[model samples]
Target: MGIFKIEGGKQLKGQIQPQGAKNEALQILCAVLLTPEKVTIHNIPDIIDVNKLIDLLGNLGVTVEKLASGSYTFQAKTVNLQYLESEAFKQDGRGLRGSIMIVGPLLARFGKGYIPKPGGDKIGRRRLDTHFEGFIKLGATFRYNREDYFYGVEATQLQGTNMLLDEASVTGTANIVMAAVLAKGTTTIYNAACEPYLQQLCNMLNRMGAKIKGIGSNLLTIEGVTSLQGTVHTMLPDMIEIGSWIGLAAMTKSELTITNVNWEYLGQIPNVFRKLGITVEKRGDDIFIPAHKNGYEIQNYIDGSVLTISDAPWPGFTPDLLSIILVVATQARGSVLIHQKMFESRLFFVDKLIDMGAKIILCDPHRAVVIGHDFKSQLKATTMTSPDIRAGVSLLIAALSAKGTSTIHNIEQIDRGYEHIDMRLKAIGAQIERV
Candidate 1:
């Protein structure tokens, strides 16, 4: 229950390199269980969730060696499968949603995988049906202990099968692909997630001897391989954090340079921010945001109607940054509609902004209309509790742009996703301290 005490309304300046893609790190880390050789990874983000998963792996007898900050080597050689039945495993496995991903590789390499119902941000009703259903399609026997809220998957042999997913779930696709890579035959996954993170996993798998095609497409074809060897993989910068920094610059009217952001993979983020009238400049893989001294403006549609910013699958705007976009829009020159299509409770945090004197209307559980203050009135700083990861960062951004000091409690939610966020903000001239 940490808290962040921040003195707001300061223009920040400096370069901030986003940590490794948190989403990708989760899936990639879980993939290490597919091989027995040493898997070296670079740019591993130092965050709570990722660290928890690393600890969970260590608890399961994976050899983890820290090479340096943001670098690590993992070897799952001689994993203790018996630990999966231990009470420690139930408690450790229930700690994060990413723990569910370990089940796929465990079922692929070993014979069984068991985990308690995973925990994560309370943003919405995140269902595990997709992951389990995909595993079942690949010939794994699935069992659920409703009384204990535990899940188990076991298989003597996995035979690949074609599956058209009900939704293009990134984790689901990654889990199923991990299992299918070691299956007996070819597996075709239609409506798969083609996000850059997933592509990184597929690419890494290919480098490790798994045959996968359609690298950046929704339809993935995988030829089961006998075994996978370990390979080195470097993660891309977190696009969500990059987007968050962009929103921070605009909201605080600061000039900030986000270095090494992997621009090509940042699909629709810059364009979507530009739609909010924020200037997004690309400088050699780095994003340069100049001070918005005169404040930014939201754009209207080509038909002169109100603009709507919404989230979709890859190549569309990410829902994770919708909260940031919503906060940035509060200080823009015009109005925009934010539609958080993936989750219902994400928009609930707008009330906190309203309390800070912003003009926002919660249209529904999933939609909100933001009318800019145009800097004519500054948000009055106040005490707020972070409800979830993205919302917490959004509130932090709001507090950074406010007129007075603000107190943000439950900053552990922010720490779960961002690596030493207060310290990073401090390096960028932001007045934020963990208290």
Candidate 2:
């Protein structure tokens, strides 16, 4: 674990670029196993989780070549299937939740796939049932080992079929899509997760010779192909990171321009921040957030109810950015209820904000009511530990707008999602040090 020592009450001004989407990278990297030919990828964020997956791919005998700073070419012509049973693989594969997606491509190509219990942030009960159930629906035999905590799926040949998922899980949809693309017949997936990441995956697969329809909708149709060829794919900018920067600029009283943000894909994110009375200017493809010198005010509902910010599926405010929204609302003029409907434990980080003098009530595991101080009372800096990826960045924002220096332990959580976060913050004049 690492710690970040931050000196607060600094007004920053500059332009920053959002990195490649982390969620998308996880899906796209695993999708590399679908083809044996060279697949080149660009704009890959050099973060911990992504690098871990890349390393896991290399360990599985995929030839990986770093073409440039954010470009890599992957070829999986000679994969060592025997390594899947090794203890080293079990240890390595358990580090990321995205590791589950690898099973789909492996099972499709090799007729069998094995995975240890995958690990991720303790935000909530993220069920893998959706992935496995989708596999079973596609004619794969699923088996789980209780003692080893491993999951295996195998079939002589997968047959594509119609599946209406219980929930629109992003990785689950990606996994089943990968499997269905090489199956025997057409697969119709209703209630699919159609986020821009999935759209990009579908587009890339289409370029690779997989026939998929419905690029940006909840229903996806995939036609099983004999084999997919290699193709080049570039990731879009990270919308969650861009949203975080917007909240950071308002809370810290900074004028920051987030460059190349892929405005079309950032659904409701800008409007969500604007509802909190922050000024968001869209200049072409960039977003310029001016420093809120007079402080921001929360806009109440038409019925005079307290503002409620909640998370939902794509086209709704992402649950990942609700933490940032909660932290930003602490300095606003009115109260707002942040309902983290997707995760049960994510709202607990508000207790750290209360420790820093922000008035927040933990209504429950899924909800927090924030009473903004209107910048009349500055938060007092204190020592805290980061619990997860989004919460870590939210705490960082709080510390930057606080009255004194603060230390945040367990900064590895932040590093997993953001690439060179401290360096990026420093470039925009934030006083943060990795200690």
Candidate 3:
């Protein structure tokens, strides 16, 4: 129930290092449960969701020791899967979608997995059918009781086969890949999500004895092994945070430098932002944003018409970042239509933007038309509560550019992803306080 009070209209200027990706860290932590060896992870983000996963793992008898600020040593040498029955474990595990990932690893190693309904961003109806379908294909039986979903694999030997996912769910693909790595035969997964996070998961699993092919492609081939050993790996810097920082610098007209960004894994961030007229300068592993004075120009079609920003599967503009980019576009020069095909309710938060003097048209649950203010900063401060991770960040950006002080509650939602956001923004001259 915390709130953030921000006095707007200040330029942010500083060097900020993006933290480890929360999405990647969540699955890698669950991978520790697959083996009873010591696993050391470096550059782990100190976020709410990661800490909750650690607590859940500890409840299941995994020994998680914090070695440093962004480093941890986890040993699931004696994990008791029965902790799933405990209320504390169930509540914490139900807090995020990544918790469902533990179901696959636990079932693969221990022959049984218990999971409750997951709670995450209410962006859309995210289905767990993909996870269950993959599980059933790998010799697992699923039963749904009144409240919880139970999965049991009574087969003495799990045999891998061909799996064609119904949709390219990011976490669903990761869950199935983890389960298939310990099966008996070779597993072929088609239509898999190939995000950078998924690539990291595959690489980490390979380092631990699992053979996976097509690292950054949609089709994945996993060669099952008897067991996996422990290994130490460093996670890549967060790409979402890099994109969030870029949007923040662009909207507030700030000069900022993002350090330790993985230039090779930028995906479509550069091209997408360039469409909205944002310039990014790359110097080695660092990216610098100059003080943006003149508002950026939107890209027009070849026939001198308006263009749109839409989200697609991997190797396309990520749906996770559309909300942030939309907010940034509101402060730019021209107009663009943001099409969110993956989620039905994600674009609904734009009504709050409309309340703050932004000219936006809610075309449908999946699309919105945003007209920029052409460098005008007439947004008035308002009281609002964060809805989700990306939406919360977008609202924060709107709050930062508003004319007066704005109060946003439920900052814990924002903390689930961004690392020490208030402190980092303070270093860059933005006046934000946690109360």
TM-score of predicted structure 2: 0.99
lDDT of 2 by residue, 17-107 (tens): 9999999999999999999999999999999999999999999999999999989999999999999999999999899888999999999
Which model scores highest in lDDT? 2
- Among all windows of 10 consecutive residues in model 3, the one with the lowest summed lDDT is 147-156
Q: How big is the RMSD of model 2?
A: 0.6
Clashes per candidate (backbone, < 3 Å): 0, 0, 0
Which ranges in model 2 have alpha carbons more than 4 Å from their true place? none
Per-residue lDDT tens digits for candidate 3, residues 1-435, read 889999987888889999999889988888998888899999999998888888888889999999999999999889786677667776776787778899888877887777888877888899989988898898887877654644334345668999899999888999999889999999999999999989999999999999999999989999999899999989999998999999998988888899989999998997888888888989899999888888788888789788888998889988889999899989888899999998998998887888888989999998888899977656778889898999999999989988899999888889998899999889888999999
**Over 4 Å off in model 3, which ranges?**
148-155
- Candidates' TM-scores? 0.99, 0.99, 0.97
Q: Which window of 10 residues has the lowest lDDT sum in candidate 2?
A: 342-351
Tell how far residue 2 is off in model 3, in angstroms: 0.4
Name model 1 segments beyond 4 Å from true: none
Candidate 1, residues 4-110: lDDT per residue as tens digits? Answer: 99999999999999999999999999999999999999999999999999999998899999999999999999899989888888988888989999999999999
Model 3, residue 385: displacement in angstroms? 1.0
Give me the overall lDDT of model 1. 0.94
Model 3: lDDT to the true structure: 0.88
Residue pairs in candidate 1 whose N, alpha carbon or C atoms collide under 3 angstroms: none
lDDT rank, highest first? 2, 1, 3
